[model samples]
Target: MSRTGRFGENLAINGIDGSYGWPVIGHTFDYLSDTYAFGRTMRARYGDVYRCSAFLQNFIVFNSPDGAEFVLKDEASQFSSKLGWEAFLGRLFPHSLPTMDFSEHRHHRRIMQSVFKKQALVGYVPLIDQVVIGNLRTWPTHQAMPAYPAIKALTLDIAAKAFLGLELKQDTHFINQNFIKLNNGLAAIIPWPLPGTALHQALKARSNIFNYFSPLIPQKRRSEGQDIFSRLCQAQDENGADFSDQAILFHLSNVLAAAHDTSTTSLTITLDLLCQHPEWQQRLREQCLRIDPQDITYDNLESLEEIEWVFREALRLFPPAPQLFRRSIKECQFGNHIIPANTQVMVDCGYIHRSEHYWNEPTKFDPERFSPARNEHKAHPYNWFPFGGGSHTCIGLRFAIMTAKIALYHLLRDYSVFATEQARYRILPITKPRNGLPVILTKN
Candidate 1:
């Protein structure tokens, strides 16, 4: 190894090379327009490990499951999520668990873990059930109604009730708008706080969310409520350093948006698919009717395994967080290329899910792929990890699935929703219909 003027000796300067178009911006716009196409082009050209620019930073993407496990499992201690996500989400989600790394993340995760435990989830179910049925009760029938926007509102309501135990009726319009802006900021072409921009609105919204919840932290402290806010108020790290008021507000706001956005995006995908394939809708509806009327009960929830299969396929087909991001802590080898230290990296799990290498008719929306007989997901463990994998797996994974299942239970049993047209979605911030996918509702 030879020393360079200001760089490391074991350099892979030639190895990390690739042309991603344009000098500074690189393939950033290309990635924004269509992630699958850009990723396919990059993977076809540079194989598993390649170099490209996105959001004004060099992204060394490991576009395979092996690359995913290497960074996601991170047994080698060569990656930092804090630095990796810093550019994309650090503004609104600073100090959040997903943005923290190593011991800090472990400490916070330990305290926050109990919030989604069995005991806590037991209290959350009633709130979720009430919201799902109550919302759908109002949905008009025999007309084309937009599913994504309505689902978005419902998920936000669920977040307010189940996660925070708040009604937020008057603030629903304000709160929902803020989250929309915040999500839009994730893939903004110019992700800066230029006034009137999506990023600016998101920053302002983040401030508003913090301000709104700042006063409630005191109430949650004195309350014995089982909601996430109260649990966070009472939570403590290993050394018993209780999260400060600001920390609680920050973490809660961040996670509330996360739960709201990801769940809304994912459940909307399931709805779109069920609408398109009326046969699956009919099958799942019949399955739902066989279960107890109160199908959200733990036992009954488990019995809706077909709903689970549909959910799995929906997530695989259109993951909310399509790419997993990380930054190398040290020089690391991936495939034939050596990734430079401190380089931002993304593992394209979306591509992996649809990759012909691990899937049969990968593009087809076949829930049977997840059934016990087929178990196509068994082709590879990493091939189907939509909530992500390893240590940083989503904290609310079980809760999210349970919520979606409960919603579907009510929906399918009550009405048969037909797709108004073919559903097409994009993943700029959240996975959602590019034109607001509409469904025609009819009483069953």
Candidate 2:
């Protein structure tokens, strides 16, 4: 069938307006090719509430903060995160928190929350600092290096040590390799496990991860270790029910991926921005110098005001998870449109984060916009939701922040970084440097 015929039969029947692009493939190519441009073009042409098909499914894109708030908060209990993420991550990461819904999601999140509480987070600081400081020291000073891959490797090591309690180099190396394969599969347009496909490799990686952690779970549950893995093994809900073996495996896989991927992206972008604006780098470095590295702790991390602003601005500019997905469980009204049950909903957070209507000089790398004097993000509750909002917000919100601050503190305190002019980025999957963010670290 033609594009209009397909759209009319599927989308228009529900009273939503937008193009389905092609018949079967829809706008998959357009979306995967340039997610931001496609989103911006759609908003410009069809406004906030519009329907489009991609990855063999129909999605109603919401580009406004209010729309984001509605789906994220789910005050009416009208959406299912499980159904929403199932298509993308189900095969690769089954039973993970992001793929869970409503009550089940809450139950699992509550038990998992113990591992990220303030006391647990405080213990993680030294683990993070050790990995970061050691890695930064090994980085060749005064020589240009690809910062993205380097930081990606560093964050993976940190995740291994801090989250999984894996310190052996060979063990961390194995986890890093497989996790990369698993992450790469998330962007697969075809989610099949056919030979040599991204999904096939990811499936294999998932099995490998399961095998690696299966034997360790029993041992971890019996111990009182400090790493997240041990804590998770020992964590119990109100009913004193600990996670089953399968649950532990799933949670560990999900948390390790989340811990590293997001920090790597945020840190890469923040470093690139600082490289492009040395004035801010020097200013942030000066602030870091004042605080003795030994004085930096989870409780005092917020005291490094300049570093926090810079990282927050980087997240605002390029949120690692730019689009938050949800599926309507029942017919619901979102703004002026009626959304039918079982419809996939995407909050265009990337667009909202940089919308001219919501921010002054939205595209500029101005960290001061986040300062208390300015507090531009305070204009709207949903405006700066990089970690998401409401009940479904990232459980690791503070952990990710703490990890970023500790890494930044160690690096900036010892070295000044300079980017090779004009570093560009690609936004799909997650925002990352197109050229790996090449930069040189110069000892101060």
Candidate 3:
């Protein structure tokens, strides 16, 4: 399973290559510095596929659509995305679905799929709309507010009510603190188990979340409720096997993180773009006002074809999960190269989404590209994988889109968003807009 193809089998030492100032530790430094820089530098030097040694292991960057296919589809069984992510989230949520694999992975995925059923989503629409409308009332009429916090607040409330059945708005500080600690814990490279460390706080929040849901699951199992956790409590497979209490607890935790973070990120990007394009914002507002505002339903969401384009375009520009990683389970040959077992393969969707070969005027935020005529994404199925693809693709993609659109509909219809002169400057960790996106929210 040695390295094959043009790059050869040697471990990619960071400093030796003329690419970056690898120095003593070489490539490992850049890999940990930041994900964007790491992929950009490697692609700039290695063309499509390049091998480098980092953290004392051989790592490869698959920069092209074909390269991603090699790992994502060609020989997928030989790679594991959960391994690297598990190592990253080990301290805070090591027991969650993202950390399980093989038979255990399949068992959890089956039970989890039940919570996203048609009837379940149908009941969530009104609950989500209520949360969105209530939160928007707090925004100032003309002052610019940070879009990140606004959306983050909105999504958290929606998750609390719709997914976990907890009313968190009145308890904003507790809710926000729990989320901050959870995010900090996930980002800790070295386990944050030390007292007073960010990871420690995150671990405590994790425990609090589990304890909070423990009693809720039993109550939910006895009753038929619309919330996702209620459905998870009663979930069963075709064979009628049910999930245990521990499995339900972990699965519900996965729902909270997945439902909140991605929706917030996507909604922020949507508002950011709407602020930059007032005309589109008006168009969306008109679309929303036409609907019976009081009768917001899942079916009403499909009528929002135009806003859908804006959401897709934003996802293209800044996918919530920008980088994807997988570990080689076995020695495998890809094209002319042979990848050794245990080697980690990384794909930059951020780079691929903006690649000129796949997208026309890739940097421009034009929603028309997603129109039926252009359909830029049709160029390559895997090229526009913001939600990822294949067997392991996001199970909650439909829910993410539906939740985001509802929030955007309420926000855009009532307010016109404008980025401040100092806006657009930010950072990205789990999602871009590292700094909260500051913007003026003028009443429409």
Best by TM-score: 2
For model 1, state the Cα shift of residue 135 in Å: 0.5
Estimate, for each residue in 1-444, the C-alpha lDDT of model 1 and write its tens digit. 332211122223445766656876777778778887777777778777777766666677776788888989898888988777877788768898878899889988899998999888888888889999989988889999888889988998898888888898899999998878877887766767899988888888888888888888888988888788889999876678888888798889878888999998888889988877889999999999997766467656889999999999999988888888877888878666777776678889888888887799988999999999998887666878888777789999999999999999999998999878877777777878886888888998
For model 1, the stretches where C-alpha displacement exceeds 4 angstroms are 1-14
- Candidate 1 has what TM-score? 0.95
lDDT string for model 3 (1-444, tens) is 234322232343232233423443446556545655666666777676666644333566677887777676634487776664644555555656666666777787887887776777888899999998989898877786777887888888888888877776577677666766777666554443788876778888878778877977779888767788777888888789888888787777766776677787788888878878888998889988988878789998989888899999999987876666677767777666667666666677878887777789988989989889889888777788888755567888888888877988888878777888434422234564755878888776
**Residue pairs clashing, model 2:** none
Worst 10-residue lDDT window, candidate 3: 1-10
Worst-scoring 10-residue span by lDDT in model 2: 1-10
lDDT at residue 422 of model 3 (Cα atoms): 39
User: Which residue segments of model 2 deviate by more than 4 Å?
Assistant: 1-14
TM-score ranking from best to worst? 2, 1, 3
Clash count, predicted structure 2:
0
